[model samples]
Target: MVHRKHNRVDGKGRIVIPVKIRQAMGIEPGSMIEFDYMARRHQLVIRAVTETDQRAHNRET
Candidate 1:
């Protein structure tokens, strides 16, 4: 269980994920992240890594 500190978006609309969490999640510099809004709940999300990520995982494994 990897625990991380949370950071809120600043007035300039920037949020920083902690370095440890970013490393654990495999987020890299210049990587593009997509966001989605759930139609039912009307909640926003940063999409989780998907099948392509699975392929990458397989390669590493």
Candidate 2:
């Protein structure tokens, strides 16, 4: 099942990801996250930066 939570950005423009969501994604301290804004879709996508993603990105460059 998918879990969803609402969070607000603070004055510093930082928003905290819920611990449940973080743990589900295997996101720990020092884990990198990538954010992508889909202008057409009017949505923001957040993903954990994994080694597989890094390898693919490296190959692209």
| Strongest candidate by lDDT | 2
lDDT of 1 at 10: 100
Candidate 2 residue spans exceeding 4 A from truth: 58-61
Residue 33's lDDT within candidate 2 is: 91
Please give the CA lDDT of all the candidate structures: 0.72, 0.94
Error of 1 at 16 (Å): 0.2
On TM-score, the leading prediction is 2
Least accurate 10 contiguous residues by lDDT in model 1: 45-54
- Candidate 2 local lDDT, residue 50: 100
lDDT of 2 by residue, 23-53 (tens): 9999999998999999999999999999899
- Candidate 1: list runs displaced more than 4 Å: 37-44, 48-61
Q: Rate residue 29 of model 1 by lDDT.
A: 79
TM match of model 2 to true structure? 0.83
